[model samples]
Target: MSVIIRKSLLELIFSGAFMKRWNDKLRPMELVEVDKQGHKMIVAWLLFLLNSKGMDVARKRALGESIIEGGIYDYLYRLIITDIKPPVFYRIKENPDDYRTLSNWVLDQLKPRIMPLGEGFMRGMSEYLMQPEDKGLARRILNAAHLYASYSEFKLLKSINTMDHELTEIEDSFVSRLEALRDLKGVSELLNENDNVLGRFARMCGRLRYQKRWSQTPRVPETSVLGHMFIVASYSWFFSMEVGACRARCQNNFFSGLFHDLPELLTRDIISPVKGASQEIGDLIHEYENIELERVVLTPLRDGGYAEIADRLEYFLGLEVGSEFKATINRDGEVIEASDAKLAGEYNLDTLDPKDGPLLKVSDSIAAYIEAHTALKNGISSDQLHQALYRIQQTYKEKPVIAGVQVSALLADFD
Candidate 1:
């Protein structure tokens, strides 16, 4: 199958917004799948940082892709197996025959919509879901991330649901599952340990759920910065696959998209309007974000013996290049900025550890368009959103292609 990103695939990614978690229990705030996936990926990254010390880039890429795909497979399966209690789901897993029968149904339902991603990707996803006994490190990392994110939500529920009969069991379940992974490099420190650097980092990432995008404008089913990051990451990976980017570039793009707005966690969601109002204002905000990002997040990680994470983050955020959206390649341990044309023509190779910054920028804009268009369709009306949708459409209207993908045409799907 040729690589393709169709409307169905995009919608499949966005459908997470409609799938609520903890629906069976009382919840203070709405817990949706997208936000949880976002949080899970962040935690997974932190875990990777912890355990992947001295790991080679190729192995790191493989681990990262596995985590990304595993999360996707879990999300798709859960979309079909909605609202099943955890114990019941675990019981179903224990019975291989029953679980296989159900998962096969899900794969069948998903086949058509997912096939456009190419046969290799479809195979990977199927293999991940069909095997009920994958206890590999990637699987463990994903499980730990899932538990960590779910525990975050459970903390909220415990505040108001003290009288609920299931509260104790739920709390015990979370503790047991997390404790099972204490042997992992960072899990022990992360378990209710606030001062640990990794713990503090993951907590800060979780706090992004409280930061809303387009904070000034009211929109239906409001989106958080955390959720938006995951959306962009997913889009970039899809586009990366379509463009035949190297394996390293694909992971780099996905993770770059994942953490591109991380500074916003410290600065809050500063809208583009304010950033673009004046060059001085933009530069000031940019400088402030970098200084704070390093002092608060990166420095602590490096000082705490996790320089790998900080280095990778700086590379992903393109700190030296001055913009995450700038195309770059590493040549013999030296970072070289490349033009979009140069990247496509001469540097689309895995050995370069390339990043398609131009393509990621496209993905970022496409995510923004989706957010605005979805809100407009959701019966919300505001001048800010209207102008935003119009602006994105107009900007892409004449640009027929980006990184070999027809991005302008992609936007037209919404119109």
Candidate 2:
């Protein structure tokens, strides 16, 4: 089947309007046998499309000519290139009068391609669509979509291997550690399962990125939720040591950071602007989020051998069951309001005491500042870093723990 498809693909490319029409009417997989098992069908189709018409090639080549002649080819090919390709289709569709059945076809086909690009493209598109005067925004959107599609496919290849093991050696090691942690007395059941622990922790870390206010930072790298978790956990451990805290306290802090934003896996990283609107709007959003968190995040964790762990974590985070421990740690890491803070704070930390909470805070601040300073040394501005350090210092000024720490001096090292 594949051989036949490959042999005919060249003919199809040259078939012009016929091939375009066919692609417009049906999915590429239905028209051709190039869809290889385990290989992405989209990539195969893209290869076919690219071979026939190079990216943004004028629609007047032999293949385009054939598309005009072949009714079936003309139908689907137009649907794909126009609407499904991004920027081009979306731009035209903005004027509803310009939209046709063909336009709808383009949207349906491209959805599969665009969806995999995830939050970055979604955010980027939202911003791009609002730029009313930028005539070039359409082209930029197309470029962005193309780049996103390429990156998504590349990441998919990187994440899994032929051995069929989804987790790498490093990830496997981490899973083993989680399993061991689950076996310990008083360990939560949620962290016991191999998949659940990783999924929940990954989600939590992703959410913490927003809470830590990194999302608003422009040009953040294409980081996965799990990537953020590892960094935060590492920072938590380092700060624990600097404070000469107990090993157990430090371990708890690490875990706290690891699971701080688990609720976000369900709630998503709600951006600042949307969240900061009128009180009534904010309350309505929160209500919707509460229902979603319970239905999605909490329920699944409980059912997946981590119910007890989830319960304990919920208690620790003071969301519901363990609401008693609700607290806020100041910049230097002192618990100021355990109860009210839990209800209002962005990140949940139900079980964490002031010692654990503040240590994580300091670590979070220091890590961010250090990263900023490093970036500045590499030619990025240090204004944000300076502001952050000042804010952190001010927040912790009254605390004896941070007294004489000389954070300004430490930051100067990066400069």
Off by over 4 Å in 1: none
Per-candidate TM equals: 0.96, 0.39
Worst 10 residues of 1 by lDDT: 339-348
Q: For residues 114-233, could you state the per-residue lDDT of candidate 1 as single tens digits?
A: 899989987888789888687998999999999999898888778888789999998999999999999888898779659788788888888888888999999877888888898889
State each candidate's clash count: 0, 39
Off by over 4 Å in 2: 1-155, 158-216, 219-225, 267-290, 320-355, 381-415
lDDT of each: 0.86, 0.38
The RMSD of every model to the true structure, in order and in angstroms, is 1.5, 24.3
Candidate 2, 22: how far from true, in Å? 38
Model 2 TM-score (2 dp)? 0.39
Q: What lDDT does model 2 reach?
A: 0.38
The positional error of residue 109 in candidate 1, measured at the CA in angstroms, is 1.8
